[model samples]
Target: MASKVIKIAVPVVIIVLAVVASSALISMRKPPEKKEEQRQSVLVNAETIQTEDLVYKIRSQGTVKPRLETNLSSEVNGRIVEVADNFIEGGFFNEGDLLVRVEQSDYLTNVKAAQASLANAQAALEEEKARGRVAEEEWRSFTDGTAPELGLRRPQLASALATVRSAEAELERANRDLARTEIRAPYAGLVKSRNANLGQFITRGSSVGTIYGTDVAEIRLPLTDNDAGFIQLPDFANDSVKPDVTLTATVSGEVVQWPAKLVRTEGVLDERSRVIYAVAQVQDPYQRNSPDKTPLRFGRFVQAEILGDATTNVIVVPRYLLLAQQQVLVVDKDSQLQFRPVVLERSDERHAYVRSGFLDGDRLAVSAIANPLAGTVVRVSGDTDEQVADDAASEEATALTSQVKE
Candidate 1:
């Protein structure tokens, strides 16, 4: 019985050992499963490059002022007897309009006195002429043997005529002085302030008022040396060729754009600021009778922008593409990064104009990734060739529709 029990136990043990060995062998042959955290990276899509025209430009800021502004002053001394109806601050007037009048009684009296003096001189000359004529006749009679006696010389009559002429000139001068008592406007403009009041004493060269000519306003904009290179100035006489400039002033938190023109630019650069001054002209649309009331007062703070030279068929890319000031990264057909040196023509917040180092239809990688390698495989996202073709077709269709409508 013992021998039989031993034989069964031995077989059972051998079977268990074989099963364990087979399970261990299977486990060793199978490969390990990858962890969920592990991942393979892929390159993002790059921008499509194309050929286009580029323009270089520079930009700066400046202030707005009146094209013509002046402080009106009194030419003669007197009491301010009369003030113009539009003599107060912010008043409007036309050229040749009466602005102020000094007390004219004194000037008129002087003129009348001068006239009286001229009249008296004329009377005296007539008396002298009568006497001289008598004297001349006597002299002629003596020469002709009719009478013989000393007579007045002819030179005395000539002196009397000259005195009469001098008196006439004085009368004319007095009349002119009377007319100058009333001050008139030199140009059509708006009155900015009044310095003299009615019944106030005034002297020659005294401040009467301030005026600004609003027919055309001016704006001074500063430009860096780099920006001056691209601008093409219009002919002095060609008003229409000037760039359409604009100015904005934040009043009560609202911005208003005023139409302006490029009038001129200072030829020399400012040493202190390293900038060139450019002046622009703008028409004031705010005359008293004008439908618009955008008042362009002198010395008002304003922000200005000049619409500069424009180029057609140019490529405009984001400003971020610049690396190390003047360098850019370009991706070649082999998915390799090329450090290309480029000339930057203009850079605004939104775009940059490159003069070279790029061609039309070239792919550029805008998005960056860690450990980016040259000649690596990349997949395009956001934009694709099929999408581009579709866009082109859609654009063409739109153009056809527009033409048909037209």
Candidate 2:
């Protein structure tokens, strides 16, 4: 009995001592120190707004084409007796240069025959005049009141004169036909194709070749309606200055640029594309006058950038920085984000031109912020470390002063 009681008492004492020690420790322990929650702020990159005058540049593309191209044809019927050395395809010729000559013997014979006919007609006219004079003298010796036209042979003399004029006209026609036997270039240009060769028989109005004028090259550039407003098109009624354009193309495995002028618009919108076409002209595209420049060949694809009208005092920003709804994020003087509704004057693929809604010295956020709200705190990455510290100290002081007033 005594041993049992002692064991039970000892176990009870151990349990009691453990519970008392746990309770004492809990009572002596301090509660966790309360911590004020820190408000979250975003870091973003920004730039200062500074408005300036901007000149717009509009971009377009087109294929180069000759200003003038023609199909050369023969004016007389004959065998091609001679072909000029520069009558083949890709051959260059100057204005009035003979390209091909037909058989001249037949034309020459015709000319001689017509000349002989003219001479015979003149001799007959002279003989008729002499006869008329003899008739008039015979009439005067008889009665000579006024000689009848028939007696004077006036009708015969008139017929002879008409014959002489007809012969003269025929001779002139024969000479012109003889000259047409030789086909000559009408302008300084290059031959695109040649059909007639030596000994080849050809008829009048036969297309013997095709040529392209090298004096000027033209490109038709298409512009959208939005882009058309920014550029100053040529005005036919007014003395408007032609806009300058720079054309770029790849030739001989290298990229090249040529200068051109925006000469005129097509005067109507393209039916299919719903865009306006502007024609640009490049002088001496074959480099005949400007040897140092790369020749802008016909049928080459090129891109053009036209210098457009200028605008004053506009804020230009990268296109990516613009947010939804034509808005942009700008930090206020209190370092809080403010959503600004901007008036976009114009925008390109890479940039946006703002006409209003931003003042000078406004800090525009260039970096993105997800799910931004107006008046949210933000830190500008453009600020120096010292400036950030100064800003933070100033904010803390202001907060303390406000708290004291409250």
Candidate 3:
């Protein structure tokens, strides 16, 4: 009985030992699987910093106006006898071109009457002069006689001379009135509107028409005080300096761009808008004798871009790289995240010019992330180098395209 009991116990103990060894092997394999599961990956995107030319610009909405605009009016009162053939709206005319004509019959009659009056006065003056000569001779003859009763004196001759002068003045006035019957253009311009026509009665100082000089058009753009610095303007006396500015207008679904220049600036600030008014002069290229494309017209709306300071050797980054308005995320050589404060020298909708806190070859994270904390482990992925190169090429292409369009 003792031997049988011992055999059964020994088998049972052997089975238990086998089970324990298998459990130990399984435990050793589970650790490796758990370690693999515990590993974490951080998704991130990056861009490279590069040096290029950057332009600092100020953008504003502006309206086009004629450089020289005039409201033509009738200077003399009369019935309109003739209207200029080119008096229609948008009609171009040269300086001294006849714009309108008043009935000159009445003016001519007045002139003739003035001339007749002047002639009559001249005849009377001649008679008085002949009488004065005789009187002078008689006085000389009576030089020996001391005293004689003389009813009239030399003062009467002076009064007669004054009367002749007045008649001559009236004749000159009539000549001037005759010349004023025809309305002439003071400068070469386009007719904006006509208020008077042939056979229409017009009074002095009445609105007859409006004219705008075709030589140039002006655009007034408002600027903020912050934009006053860093922009270079052309010298006025330098005739060779062409205003290297351009304006774009969208008319009838077609985009048209024209050359322009920074003409002048309003010295005082506008109280209501708190902005400085800057004027840009655009040449009229559409004139009959113009050598290039038609210049911009008066009252046309356009987007104006005034050339500002072109910065060299600056790192221009996507505007989105700025976090919370003033902070940026930079990746170091060790692949660690760093929060850097930067000074934004200039900023636009697409790009930002950073004055400091970054260098060339530094990687900048452009894509926004969730809870970007210091010392957080992350797996930096995405086309950092390739993206930077592509972005630079794209930006250069866009700038070239804009220049060509302009």
lDDT of 1 by residue, 1-406 (tens): 9999999999999999999999999988968897789453354768787657544444445665667788887777799888888988888889899989988888888888888888888887888778877887867866865442335644666677788898899888878778878888888888888898999999989988888886887778887765666666555565456766667787667777777777677767898988888887777635445656666666767766666676765556688777775766666666566666777666776677776677444577787766666565555565456678899999999999999999
lDDT at position 84, candidate 1: 88
Whole-model lDDT values for every prediction:
0.74, 0.91, 0.77
Q: Write candidate 2's Cα lDDT for 183-298 as tens digits.
A: 88889999999999889999989999999999999999999988999988897885377999999988898999999999999889889999999999999899987688789988
The 10-residue segment of model 3 with minimum total lDDT is 145-154
Model 1 spans > 4 angstroms off:
1-39, 42-45, 53-60, 125-138, 144-158, 234-241, 248-255, 310-313, 346-350, 359-361, 368-378, 383-406
Sort every candidate by TM-score, greatest first. 2, 3, 1
lDDT of 3 by residue, 25-104 (tens): 88887453434457655667776777687676656558788878889887778999888899999898999999899988
Q: After superposition, how far is residue 63 of candidate 3 from its true place, in Å?
A: 1.5
> Local error of candidate 3 at 333, Å?
2.2
* Highest-lDDT candidate: 2
Model 3 CA deviation exceeding 4 Å by range: 1-35, 38-40, 53-57, 144-154, 233-243, 291-295, 359-361, 377-406
Better of 1 and 2 by TM-score: 2
Candidates ranked, most accurate by lDDT first: 2, 3, 1
Worst 10 residues of 1 by lDDT: 145-154
